[model samples]
Target: MNVYLAEFIGVAMLIFFGCGVLAGNSLKTSGSYGAGNVAINIAWGCTVAMVIFCLGDISGAHINPAITIMNAVMGTFEWSLVPGYILAQIAGGAFGGVLVYLQFIDHWEKTDDPHAKLTIFATAPAIRNNVANFFSEYIVTFGLAFCILGMGTNVFLEGLQPLATGCLIFLVGTSFGGVTGAALNPARDLGPRLAHFFLPIAGKGTSDFKYAWIPIVAPIMGATTSGLVHNALYKGIVDYRLFAMVGLTVVTFIAIKLASEDNKEAIKNKQALNQIA
Candidate 1:
């Protein structure tokens, strides 16, 4: 199979299962409504593993751009191929998200919470703290890239990488995922989010473009720096770009914090008003 085509298929599979779970959990009329964290946690991990199992041999099953970028950073993947792979993943994810939306077309009217409807397609912050939400994405994605590299260095059973990623996703979800929904992949969130924005879904809220940059930028920063970190610790290679990236991230988030204070307060006040009403 063509590698780009494989990536498209792989990520579509990812969104099919991953968003499929969210759809079930979020749609009030769905059987899996209120299935809660355990269901999503397991579904995401299993979905990743399934994508890998089906497409690992073809396009390396890089359903996530973060993974694709990490491979490029580590020199295992071609930088030239990176753009195509990422584009394919995003398109595929959007395709899958739309399919799931159509599958539950009736449920949209049945479920009144626009936020819940949005959750079926994209991630949202549990607490809406831009700085912390940004930091949390980096933390989990760093773990994701770092551990994936760790897995690469060691000898595991021939078919074990998928399972390893599955378990790792489970860990990422249960641990720091609550803050940002662990959106470690830009394509996973952005693709479906774009769909949500343009598709005219009934009662859908803002696509949350203001918060979108965190998932895209933070995950890339985390994944790439983890490659640098892995090289420093494991290969005794201290890439100075690692420190540069860190310094830049710190400055970036500080600015984000300062600029977002009023927006954050407004959001909090809105929530408070909702509670009072």
Candidate 2:
């Protein structure tokens, strides 16, 4: 099969299993409803690893437009193939979303929360502030790209690289996923979100297009920054410590901002409750 076809299949598998778990965990009446974050982290991590293990040799198992675009920008992958890879990944993601919706059709009617239904297909911020949400995606995606580049340099046993990479995803999701749902890929968000918009699910809410740009744009920016830094550092043309310091700074900033926002929100909630009383 062609590389494009392989990418489609690989990404389909990634989304099918990854978002499948999200659907299972969030949709009412599903056996795995409320299976919790650990389950989600593990399912996504394992899905990625399984896709890579099965299709890496065939298509390099990019399975993510952000990864594809980053590699292309970094000169590691061909520019000519970027469009095909991205398109395939998005289509595959949509395909996966449709499958999950069909699988959980009954649950959609049973569940009252539209956001929960949306979560099964795409991501949203826990606390919605544009700047903070954007930064949340950026920092985590930077970590993702940086770690992926680092993983490539390591001499792990042939097939073990995928497993290691999967673990890195799990680590990032657990550590940095609190604010923004850890969508490190544009296709992962966009394709499924489009599916959510068009799919005939019962009582599903607005697709939340207002906040959609953060995931798509921020991940690309983060991945590009990581690729440039990785390429420079790998060639000894730049200091690795510089990236470490920058990453630390960004994380610190995000933490402070999120904390401040949370406190403000808490005060507002309390004030509203007191007024009601």
Candidate 3:
């Protein structure tokens, strides 16, 4: 199997179970309806571990672009392969979304809330606070990257590494999933979002494209930062990329705050106009 194909399949399976579980909880009449956070988080972790177990030897079971990017930046993965790996992961995510859609075909209409349908395929901020959402995603993904990288330093038995990594995902989910669903991977959110945009799901709402950048940008920032920190700890070499990325992350946070304020102002103006009418 080609490495790209392996990545595609790996991520496809990852989303199949991860998103499928969410669909079960959100959609009506499913056995796991309203299964709640514990179920969702554990399902995500188990899906991740299963994919890594299956694809670990073939493609290193990245299944997440954040981890791939971290490896590349940390000098473990080739930069040239980065684009293909990411593309494969996204494609896999789309395919996985399709599977979940089919798995819950009957439930889409049974589910009346467009927001729930949208979250079935993508993530949304629980509180709609952009700055807080960014902080949540960034910090969770940062922990994900930092811990996964830290795992590489140890010599785990063959099956244990996948379990450890999966447990790490569960930890992140259980701890920080409330904010932005803990989207620690760009492909994890983007691929399914593209699926949501294109697929024929009844009464599905906007794909929330405007908010999509948070998942992609925050995770990349977190991953790069984690790589820099891990490198410092492991090799003690200060890479200039660390400073650049940190500066950029700061700028991004400020931009999010500005955009959020603009959105609030727009809502206020619209509300006042409604009062006049």
Candidate 4:
């Protein structure tokens, strides 16, 4: 099979199991309804492993546009193939979302909340602050790409790469996934969100396109930053510039969180004042 085809199938499998888990957990009347975040984190990690184990040899099982873009920017993957890889992954994601919709058609009708139905197809912010959400995605994907780059080095065992990568994903989800549902991949979020927008799932509700760009843009920025630092560190230069870049990113992430909290507090105070008046 062609590399592009393998990427498509691999990512499609990723979406199939990943979103399928979401649908089962969120949609009413499903067996896994109310299963909670731990189940979701576990399922998503396992799905990543499954796809990589199956297609790793064919396409390195990127299964993520962020990974593909990072690899290309880092010069580990050919830039010429980046476009095709992204398109294939996006297509796969949409296909996976469609499959989930079909599987849970009855459940969609049973679930009256549009947000729940939409979440089965894509991610949304827990706090809904754009800057904070963007930084959350940026930091999460930075961690993802950074760890993935480390895992790809010669130190790790070759046969265990997929399992290691899956574990890394699980760690990310549990540790840093709260803000924006941890959408560390553009295709993983965007494609499914698009599916939710177009597909006629009864009362599917708005796709929340306003915040879609956070998942897409933030991941790319994070990936690019990680790739550059990883490559520089891999080359054994021990450059201080890498540290500066990382420190700046950390500070930015912290600032966003603090700012968002301040904004929420202000809103609450204003509400209280209005009530008193």
TM-score versus the correct structure, for each prediction: 0.91, 0.85, 0.95, 0.86
At residue 236, what lDDT does model 3 achieve?
Answer: 95
Which lDDT values do the candidates have, in the order given?
A: 0.87, 0.85, 0.90, 0.85
Evaluation by lDDT, superior candidate among 3 and 4: 3
Where does candidate 1 stray beyond 4 Å? Answer: 261-277
Model 4, residue 24: C-alpha shift (Å) = 0.6
Candidate number of the best TM-score:
3
lDDT per residue for candidate 4 within 1-277, as digits (tens), equals: 8999999898788888999988998887998899888888899999899888899989989988888987786667999999999999999999888888888878888888999888888889888786778878987898889888887675756668888888888889888766778989999999899889889999877999978888887898798788888877787644565566577667766776787789899999999999999
Count residue pairs with overlapping backbones in model 3: 0
Task: Count clashing residue pairs per candidate.
Answer: 0, 0, 0, 0
Point out the worst 10-residue segment of candidate 1 by lDDT. Answer: 237-246
Question: Best lDDT goes to which candidate?
Answer: 3
lDDT of 3: 0.90
Q: Which pairs clash in the backbone of model 1?
A: none
Better of 1 and 3 by lDDT: 3
Query: In model 2, how large is the Cα lDDT of residue 154?
Result: 78
Q: lDDT tens digits, residues 104-187, model 3? A: 888798878999998988888888788998888888888888898888899998699999988988988998888788898999
After superposition, candidate 2 runs with Cα above 4 Å error? 237-277
Q: Between prediction 2 and prediction 3, which has the larger TM-score? A: 3
- For residue 275, model 3's alpha carbon misses the true position, in angstroms, by 4.1
Q: Write the per-residue lDDT of candidate 1 for residues 1-277, one digit (tens) a residue.
A: 9999999998788888889899998888999888888778899999899988999999888888988887787777899999999999999989988888888888888888898888789889989777888889988899888888889888888888899999999888878767888899999999888888888688987888988898999999889888888988998877667788778878988888887887778989999999999
RMSD of 3: 1.4
